[model samples]
Target chain A: MASVVPRKSHNLRYKTLMAWLFTLPGLVVQLVFGWLPVLFAFVVAFQRYYFIKDPEYVGVNNFKEVVADPLVITAFQNTLWFAFLSVGLTFLMPIFVSILLMEMSRRTIRVMMILWFIPVASTAGIAIWKYMYHPNLGLLNGILRGLHLPEQKWLDDPVLAMFSLILPGIILFGPGLIYIAALQNVPEELYEAAELEGASFWRKIWNITLPRLRPIIAMMLLFSVIGSMQVFELPFIMTGGGPGYATTTVVMYIYSLAFGAYNLGKATALAIVLFCAIMIMVGFQRRYFPENIDESSENARS
Target chain B: MPLIPQVGRRRPKTRLMLLAIAIFLWIGVLLHLFPVAWMISASFKPTLEIFNAPFRLIPKEPSAASYKLLASTVNANGQSLNVDVFRYPLHIYLQNSIKISFLTLLCQLPITAMAAYAVSKLHSRRAAKWLFYFFMGTLMIPGQIAIVPRFLLLSHFPWPTRTVPGIPFTDLFFPSWSFIGTYWGIVLPAAFSAFNFLLFKGFFDTLPTELIEAARIDGASELTTLRAIMLPLARPVIAVTGYFTFTGAWNDFLGPWIILMSEQQKWPLSVALYKLQWALTSWQPSQGAMDPALQTLISSGVGYNALMALAVVESIPIFIAFLIFREQLMKGIQIAGLKG
Candidate 1:
């Protein structure tokens, strides 16, 4: 006696159709909000125009003007310098702090990690470092006075102003958390193996820990560079782009042009240029540092 | 399995030093909290007591006078219009912020999550891989370049509601460039973020493949499977993204500053706080009957207090949510970081 068997062939065609349908929303968003506008920004860079008026094709004048203007030149140079110094400081501080944090017992490390993360969660604009920089009544100045040293107008002098802007953010670094996370992810066997080989704490860090952390170090460097280049609110609030444009950043420049002066075309042009510059530099960095330098050759020298 | 365990006891001195370091970290935390505490303490003080001879860590006489000022009314059109003459009515702004944030989240999160899932989980292996690459590639494009065109598009939007041809209500709705100071202007641009989509995709990829296979064998439709199974499973990641989105909207100042006129009544608290100082210092508060020194100090202190209050109020929701979902939030963050 033969039984009537059920025929069931799962059709994946329905899944394919459903998948496309599901992706439609994101496609629309990226098309409208991302790609289209970015394309227009590139087009705007080749033209000289304002928001209300028609754009006139000026092929490279905007770039030439950007390069020729002394202020723009200074901004570019200052941006690079700021990026280098700030990224170095941020990248190095975290690695050192993370190593220190790793040396702690598990219970203590959790507490330290939690404390390190609180400031990162808080609003960047609300921190009152500018107020604390007040010459007469400020905390820093008060300390200087206590030591019988003359007070300085922290926000007034051009040479010291940019450093002042960076000073407040130094203590606000959240790299400790990232470094801790990276350190925790390292395999315990490697440490045990190193210990069996008579590796000291510092030697373990140099030989294994730092090498393992190289990728994260690279990531932190890239982010710090981008972040410092885009610094806006802190300096904007503190100095208002002054003691005479000493600390005016690329983003601040675009802001003043577009919103302050109503030159949307030029602003868009500048923005596109900055974006390209960042991409090229970052691409170069990634290409040059393809394999992270994680070898253990220099363990004894340091 | 235990991830780590003692291979023998550590030395006592190393243990003591670690304890000391932990204490130092707590002290560092106290330092970080100092400004925030000052901001809170300043908000409770009366206007006259702001620059009191010595700084008040704990307010000598705490009052809700500032918050009251933010909610009080001024006479207009022969009646009170609930205008805040000194401080902006932050409570109203807070409501608008909540409405926009929730609307944006409700509309965007499921849609983006679905898209991300489709790209990552619901396709032939090759198709999914290529789609993932394309989506990730978009992250290379910075947001600044898109500002001008986006603004132009928003400003020149055709009217949503229209009238019948040759009717009395011909002007009911015409092509209009009048969204500058409206809620839609803020919501439309901010609703779809790539970062959230990528985050969700990362979460979805880590999920076991067996669940999908089980549902498929059960003859559940793809959409049904997504709705009934995937969405519920993605809760922790969704929650983190939702909180971040809400806070981003609440704290966004640049968008409003660009689109809104100074006197627009519907601006968010961030914009209101910024404009508050600009309005006061426009003609220099020290120019008139007030003594220059006192006027400057008072104006600065007032501005500072308003900013502090706004920041604290805006941050409370995110902090509470984070505390509630602490464990899952950390896990979600780790997933996102690894993918990044």
Candidate 2:
């Protein structure tokens, strides 16, 4: 019996060691690339770092410089405008689209989904939009000219550029995969009950569908806000933050500061500020629009 | 009073609603696909025909001039346009993208799956809880915060600066090695994704422990069991995760844009396309006055046609990947959305 106990302990130790061996590589990668850089971002935010020289700890000077930079304000305003407009314009699209799609035949739905989500590379999508937005030679202008309408500078006009950046998303809207999945989870009994009550289609959607979709809507809202706030590639590719800083987002500003100007410290400082803002927004969202529906019902059922 | 509406009235209204919905959705789909179709059509048009009036959706005279330009460096005038800016051919950028994406997959899949398996099945309850948190805690923090620091770290590896702890002077500090201007810089940081780790762990949790225990009793090692038993059952998860990872890495722009900026030959198609667009568009007549070749190229509209061709090239692989993994990709999204 004593010998068997020792052997069991030996086996346990070997198992633990094996577990650690499996975990170590992933842990090392996460530490070096994920956690360490995040920690280093805090440190870099307080220091002045030019690649040519050793970093000098400036103690809030980078933050001060970030504040002083006139472009910072413009970037923030543009980002906020983008986030608000994107949410207002496109957030509920997938939910409504999914509801409409639920009425479609299965074959039709599949065909529509394939057409809608064609897997165009994001940069390629941006390039396509950039060409379409061209003033003189673009297809949009060509169509306008054919219609005998005056051609407008789509991207070069400061007022229209930000709107133009998001225009493609609005036009290409479809049911998000998430929303469809959520819609599928809406109990058939609920719809049957509504049908028995003679509730109209719109009423059923408003009363049952929207309420059930609230949790997903809230979650997607948060994602959209985060995504739009960090808008970089579209504006960067389409306008180069051009038409005189009209479309320069906070992220694009940080990118230019880091790479274009080699002002690493200031860029990190701005990034940290953006991080804090995003965290606060997330916190507010969690408090107000809690994702408590799934868990509570799941626990009740289980 | 009747509890339900009369079938006679309800039938037509429902059919009308269904018809309206179908019409609306079909229009939406057509509008959604318009840009992609336009891109393909524009790619086939000659530079002059692209700009010509009447605005045909189908090109009047479809030509391979733009594609031929991308395939080779020399234009019809026998002048080297160097559209990619670094003078490397289009295939070189494609090769770099493929190499980096494949390396990322090679490193990411096994490392992530192993860690997920350990957390999901091998670890003790308390230990698993802690390890899962450790891996997933990074998800709460936005990735942009790490961008600058990561760039700096890649530029001067092991140490972000020329300073080491316990060393008296800054001069004594030296980086172990730099990953800048290399594929490792892009591939290393992407080797373990917290989101994918969660997906893997969730999938693995659904696997029965008795199977693994049976393998153990049959004298199979943990690695052997994972390989010979768990992997066969994990084909769907593997396919979904692999597709996401490959497409993500393939389409990543900023990472390659920053890390491989100086090494233009190593730039991916995304960065190369960006540079090409910038160079072509930023070419002012005043700037090109000294170079007749530049003026001729600008006036010919070849740059615009070539840009469209590049866009087509960039989108083809992702389209093919989607087609191949269509079911798995949709299932993955459905699972992720429901779980979230």
TM-score of each: 0.85, 0.93
- Model 1 lDDT tens row, B170-234: 65533456556777777766656777888888888888878987998898888888889998998
Q: For all the predictions, what are the DockQ values?
A: 0.37, 0.55
Q: Which candidate has the highest lDDT of all?
A: 2
Question: Candidate 2: which pairs clash?
Answer: none
TM-score of 2: 0.93
* Residue ranges of candidate 1 with Cα displaced over 4 Å: A1-10, A103-107, A119-124, A173-177, A291-302, B1-10, B73-88, B157-179, B261-263, B277-303
Q: Give lDDT tens digits, candidate 2, residues B1-340.
A: 1112345335776668677888999889998888888888888888778666425778888888888767776666676764455376678878887898899999999999999999999999999999989899988788888888887777667776534333466545443678889999999999999978987898888889999889988989999999999988877678878988988998899889888878987988889788877766765444545355455555545666778888888888888888988887666666666565
Over 4 Å off, model 2: A1-4, A294-302, B1-10, B82-86, B162-175, B284-293, B299-301
Model 2 is docked with a DockQ of: 0.55
Model 1 clash pairs are none
Considering summed lDDT, which 10 consecutive residues are worst modelled in model 2 chain A?
A: A292-301
How many clashes would you count in candidate 1? 0
Worst 10-residue lDDT window for candidate 1 chain A reads A1-10
Model 1, B266: alpha-carbon shift in Å?
2.5
Per-residue lDDT tens digits of candidate 1, residues A1-302?
Answer: 12322222125566788878988877776666666667777777777867666668898888777777677666676677667767755557666765766655667665656555542223324345654666654556766878999887787778878778777556654345456656667888898887788876668877788777788777766766667776666666667677788878788888888778877667777887789888888898787654356333354356
